[model samples]
Target: MFKTSLDKFTSINRIAVISDSALGFGSPDIIGLADGLCAHFGAKGILVQPDDLNRPLVDINFTADVRSVRLFSDLPTYTRSWRWNFFRLAARAVDEFKPDIVVVVGPNGYGASRALRHRPKLLVYYMLEMATTEPLYADLHKHYGNADIDAYIIPDIERHNIDFGNLHWRKDVDFEGIYLTAPINYPVPIKPRAADDRNGKSIYFGHIHPEETLLDNMLTPQLNDCEIEFFGRIGDADRGVIANRIASTPGKAYRGLQTPEDLADTLPRFNFSLVTWKPEGHIGRFHLPATKLYHSVLAGVPIIAVPNPLNVYFIRKLGIGLLMDGWSRRSFIESIQAAKAMIGSDAYRSMVDRCRVAAEGEFAWSRQVSRCAALVERALEKKWRRLYGPRKSQPALAANG
Candidate 1:
């Protein structure tokens, strides 16, 4: 609907985005930014999601009218299968659309290879979660192909030196700067608490990846004090067990899926938010992009993140929220104790103020979509630069090979 309606004022030649399994892609943070960019920039955007993954999320997709955005499904059987289908359709999309650039919000080397072979300009956005403590070991020399593809990485946890490389990835431009992906671009239909609804409680939400489930015991002590509202799709069977136990506990509410509007009302009542655990792996350490922090920030609540590489790095920079060392009960308790001390202190209020600032200025989708649009525009320019460059070369790599 949006794609067809957009031709009068703007012309988005072509752009591509693929993030999750279903591909409705309308999360409050990322998709909101992407859709807003396409609309504001007068560019047409088509999101590619797996058919199997998309249908169930129709309600979520519609929450912000993202269902009206253009989309085509060539979704596959499984993730590995999705890769094959994704690249193939992506190639066809590029060929048919004849887009100025091909983009993937996450690291997509396979698509990069195709985009490079097809023409010249291929844009890749690497959303970073943790830089120093978390480690994502992609073969910089291998997966990245060559230096022609401008790489922009951020949430700049490991700014100075990290796993990727010391030398700047850009050939001549400084495209690689710290960027904070905005939370979803919801219409703000619901108003937050009118200041009297604040209640003290520690809560966390988001994916409960297998490795991070180790921290469930920490809540046993505090589950009795206040509503320990735990929400999210249980990642796996064992994680479900952990979630079920916590949810089953008295006073701990497992308030199932709440719409963005519901969250606006419900979240403001909670005094503290939780961001716990880092999986002991590459992807876990380096990239933990939790929009919950932005949610907590926006809700006027502080995040109680685990004391790991990611949280340590964020506090030192963004200066928002507190950290619990280890997902251990002692650590969580002590941290909240520290938080209580600081809550009445200047530092805590300042953190709350900073969170609100980030929610409006740094974390909101309105500003982020524009920044992303700029990046997209720049990436397309670079692509064109290489496509029509004096010496740009194209080597046709095997797609299904």
Candidate 2:
């Protein structure tokens, strides 16, 4: 199906993906992009990441070869000196692969620079967060400014405008960037549940920060009518606290970490997915796009999100979900109440229909693959002209000759 997507760029063969987080560990975009490129172009690639022995390795069902490099230490150190060692190890793997394009995921300054040393035809940076206030990100911005990146891929344009617009690097006249949200594996077949069959169940996945997300406050008796499920990673400190809270709640459960494949089967069983974020600090202000939004839609389920501009924009644009009016616990309760009321209504069914439509079109990862290919083609064209000047017209005397 994707055979024609890269017909214009046949010269492009192999790709290299470098990231601090390993595939299926924390970086879903990296996994999707690498897998999509392989499926689209029928290209071979290599994935190089730091080996985290603490976490079990996830089996990523992709075409690329995986290489894990052990970092000097895993003690949450962001110092350039420490990261440089990782870069050195990762670069060796990348060098051996000899990719035509190098895509660096996340804010790894030394790693990005090291990848550039390979002098691939195209260098792409995929920004994971817009937390400019963080010292590590600020330091990495310096490396990003100096690196000769051919293109950039961000989660969405709103986050870029809010957090990265003022950066000097983004102002370059030649800068090329694309905003892609978390993509759903296509052909998943969205099957919206019938109204009569619906139950008042909701889900919250990804990081499970009890206090930061006000999830602790929302788990009271007021929301006893709805059943909520929690999944994904949690800090060691908060695990016991969150587990106790879930246990005390009448209809709450913590299902622990499940793979994306497993969640694909589980998501459709819920009526809505909760897209909550802390209403303050860098996370709140930047409001990075939530992967759950697409995940919900892909399963023919709607979402109930807090009042973040990006989330609100998509919810309104697609009419696939509801947004809370405020960040207080009362607002959270009200939003759930609102969703519960709409569960069996025509509006709710319409939302489900919209999700199916979106999953088949906009939310599909295949669409992002096409756009990514197009961006690479554009970059390759510019590179060709820069190396060997634009094609010249032949003399006009062919007929006369």
Candidate 3:
């Protein structure tokens, strides 16, 4: 209905994005941000990868008009042929999306040059995990080269600078920030269950994929008085490794993944939410953008995140959550102990309350998107000047083509 009402208007600028709609912990949170943004700005948002067989894909309530122009929404599929089909699809999207900006999720896209070639557009890449740790510099240079590209958005910028010594040659990467795509206001969850609400146990949430052995090695060894509860599913390798570690511990159990709606009710009951188990190298250290953090922040739950680049920046900037450094089972135990102690104290509850207040005031979707409109305008600067007036050059690169 909204799209129908707006048909009288010309097609607005489109943004072609390449990303994995992973549904990492099962929050289609980002899509809400995209939909909200498009509606607010009167622009078109095409999310490239939410249509995959992956369970708990980014499911969100969208306005009448919502679409993700996809590549390979599945990370496994994207990784398998990182060099193959994605390039072709990316180049094709350039021609098809007629976008003002092209957002690429990067480990290195093979066809970036092809996509951006001869187009007056900006290419925004979210260097979440790969900008820091990928081994193939040659391929990355090829992708980041000045063909059709423009700017970058990273989750791990501080580490990307420190670990890589320079991010894409110390280029202008926007670590200044990215917002979680969640609703501005959420319905408060039902009061947590008294049975589940206890500092007697700690809960760790997320999927267990084998590639993250860095996480496994860090969290497994502690046999302590602190009872640990595990939620979310594990792939085979993670199952073998994680199951073996928890076998003897009566308090450790895997409850599989739950929806964000479920977490709103479930998370508040836990003594504390464990943010992560690893903080090694660039990948482990810098790339931990768990949706859990947002939920915890919003729910006013005390969280335990590792002191990676993003978290450190978030901690300093937000002053909301707590962090642990290094992978020592000792550090893990200590932090959990500290969190447990804090949970029992008024000080910690106060900290949680403060964070929730911050979320409501600053991080809410409606408020956060105001900046994205400027980002879109930056990408379309030249176009707005040409088409809409001196201030209205449309950035839709393929418009004339």
* Model 1 C-alpha lDDT per residue in residues 116-163, reported as the tens digit of each score: 335524455444322223122134234444355454534544532343
Best by TM-score: 2
lDDT of 3 at 350: 63
Best by lDDT: 2
Residue pairs clashing, model 2: none
**Decreasing lDDT order of the candidates:** 2, 3, 1
Worst 10 residues of 1 by lDDT: 128-137
Candidate 2 lDDT for residue 38: 59
What clash pairs does model 1 have?
Answer: 22-53, 28-184, 29-183, 29-184, 50-75, 121-383, 134-285, 134-286
TM-score of model 1 relative to the true fold?
Answer: 0.72
- Per-residue CA lDDT of model 3 for 201-229, tens digit only, reads 67777765434433443345453466676
